[model samples]
Target: MTDLDAIPDDPSALRAALLAMRAELAAERALRRGLEDRNERLQHFIRQLQRMQFGRRSEALDPDQLNLALEDLEQAVAEADAEAEKADPPRREARARERRQNRGTLPGHLPRIEVVIEPPTTICPCCSGAMHIIGEDRSERLDVIPMRWQVIVTRRPKYGCRACGSAVVQAPAPPRLIEGGLPTERLVAHVLVAKYADHAPLYRQAQMLARQGIALDRSTLASWVGTAAAELKPLWRLLRDDLLGSAKLFVDETPAPVLDPGRGRTKTSWFWAIARDDRPWGGADPPAVVFTYAPGRGHAHAATLLKDFRGILQTDAYAAYKAVAGAAGDEAAAGSADGGVLLAHCWAHCRRRFYEVAQKRPAPIAHEALRRIAALYEIEAEIRGRPACERRAVRQARTKPLLDAMRPWLEQCRAQLSKKSPLGEAIGYPLNQWEGLTLFLDDGRIEIDSNVIERSMRPIALNRKNALFAGHDLGAENWAVLASLIETCKWHAVNPEAWLADVLARLVSGWPNRRLAELTPWAWKAEQDALHRAAA
Candidate 1:
């Protein structure tokens, strides 16, 4: 009415009016958006609280009603405490086992029998004619010696022929487990086991050794692990080749410490694992499992480890893996491996993020996803230890539908939810890993999660937690080999201590090429079993 545009030459008044109106509009919109996001997140948390409080219902949960129950809150807190306890170093479990082991000795070459001795006869000298034996007296018990470390000196004698001025030479000495290295095969194995299996840190290991009267230092022990790893590189390569050649593999990664020689700081090392099967593929020949160490979480390392990998590669949805997938596609297109890399997504990994956010917002989508996945796992449980064909059939008939149903639901939730929210993040991360997640669905050979490899990685994680960061790169890589061997033995149901001792004895005997494969956990296990049967 006042012809404001024509009067807008008054810049101060125009600007102030525009700013005030814009501020009011922004405030109103911001208030509405904030409430929507809060409600969304809260809704997710409530749903989680309900699921934790009540036995899970097949029907979806309502976020609004979830807050009405304090029982859910109490139950979830208990669960969180339980998880925290689990996250702790498994030292208590190890302590229990150690106590059990201490209570009973193995059937060693030495006998564990105890003999009772009657006390010497006692009577007055004057009444010696009626001497009588006294009650048995207490005797000192025998004490077992602690573990002692000593260097074995192996000398090769030279020979010469006196006749015709002819000279004779003896065969050369075989390489030591560590050339010019002071540690014994047993010591190396002990250090490896302590670090990986026992999760004992190097410094702690040094202390343990000291108690055994061995004056070893952590720095020195670290070197032993590195050198031993170098010696085992060939075995790691062989394992990697075998894993890639397999038709199915379950793979995962966890963080590792790598000392940067130049920077003097520990860099992040991801332990990448490729395993064929976890719960016994139950085939005549077991699938191979391999582990590799890389400094960066990049595709190049994966590309190298899987250079000839034409078979199914099961893994989680890490972006680095996608690059690997892209590279594998290129390789396949170029007829490199001659087969394509199939993707398998881990429903557990996908469910876990949602579960985490569900702590804040118990969203139905997360709980429902977990329920659906649980059903698939239940089917797997029902078909436990079944052959691939049988498992595939069961999964196809039952589990496939759950997967099919999950995809559309994920898509709808992704669309309906705010992109910025944690629910979106939780859903998107696994969805991104979708390529790997969906791999098992396409093929029966694939598994639900990359747990096979992840299980193998647990020992490493346990060891890392105890030992802390590795002292050096070589030490970390060495750990990878030892872990590969130990984990592989475990996977094949082989006793690690036995397999390790046997392999160490053989390898230190010059790593017999004709019998090197037998040094592998899987191979050595068979040999050990065969010998046991023969002796029996």
Candidate 2:
């Protein structure tokens, strides 16, 4: 009943003070709620990282998950473009760019095996007179002569020795890849190049051969392939050793399914493609790719394949690669303690993760990340063929600053996003492998991504897609061997068919192992060109 109690009961003046106190309390509550929400997001981020890094990948987003919505959007865009095109015709330049009908001049080196298609009647009907020799309009169409089956009769003339009447003189027949087989080395090479390089299934090739009245069974062709693979393995080993000796290399692997007879189903194998291409940064080594088939995708496989290699190995952020790098300390794999292989991770893979998430959920953070990474690619496109020193300077000047800004920016995004979200999961990849991801910044000789090796795997993919799977483990090994040589020929811009044909002939003709480099696609090309010039 004092003045204080009376003041508490008062309405107007106390109300203003109470209102101010209530406003302050509401703000504190709002801030606390915000802190709690942020903490929840952070916890999700941590859980996502832990799950990805340690927990089963099945728990995380499936790396191979497809976004159907993206396909739908693309189809919709195409339809819209088609409608627009119908309304307004395409520009001349665009039409010209699209037109691929222009036939170019064939190579001058090809022999002119002419078959003059004369007219049915050379006489003029009006005059009933035979037309004299006149200028003829010549049009060229590429003609392929069906494979001619020939019997190479090697007649070794026998004679009685003059000094000794009982002795007989005879010449020995040449050694062949297939001792009693009817196929010539060139024929075997043709079959191999068709199956491996051209992605033709053996059955299809057998059918084609049967049309020529050869009637060779599919098993016969398969046996030839197997024997050829065995014969060519020494060359494959040499190529692999040479590739490993390169200072910088790109590495990748694609699934190669092998038929498991015991299980009555196909088992997954791997064709590990190790590639060396120093041309990007202007290194002298010619680009090459060698494929090794393994029964499993175990870390030991990578270890064995790269055991002798002691340089930069650019690859994707596959966990097995991490183990491979770790095992550099082991004497068995390392060759020597000082000969440890350096790891360089692919940025394309990092961009790919963010790209997938961006497609599903459009956000400013992901869009920004994509835009910044695109800028790095733009810089790479510009300086691709430049010398290493110049490339290094440009990267340091242009790419380095963007990368420097990107690190903190990514961290800030991580702080804002929940790690469990797709964007957060995408962001965690580059963050975890940041050191490997940024290895290119230090060495210009190293590429940003293992795309060279990836490009080399496409033929294998095509071959597998057509052939389904190899019949057995040895079949997969043969696939690897032939694919490696044929793909390497393709890498050097050599006609794979021509190279295989020539190499096979030389191999059967006793090409020395010490002079194996002469039969290599690049060297053989130079030698062929030189011979052509000398003939000219």
Best by TM-score: 2
Residue 298 CA displacement from its true place in model 1, Å: 1.8
What is the overall TM-score of model 1 with all chains considered together?
0.64
- Name the 10 consecutive residues with the lowest summed lDDT in model 1: 134-143
lDDT of 2 by residue, 1-536 (tens): 33665466567778986898799999889868866865674464345334533455443322211111111122222223333333344532343234223433333433454434444454444444544433333333222223544434333334343333443333344555554445667677787888887887767776786675556656556656766776677789889989988888888889998654334456899999899888888888878889999988988898888777877889998888777777774654647755676799989999999888889876888889999999999999999998888888888999999999999999999999899999999899899999998888878898888888877898899988877766556567777888889988987889877777678767867788999977777888889899999999
**Model 1 regions lying over 4 Å from their true place:** 1-184, 217-223, 261-264, 278-281, 334-337, 429-436
On the 0 to 100 scale, the lDDT of residue 494 in model 2 is: 91
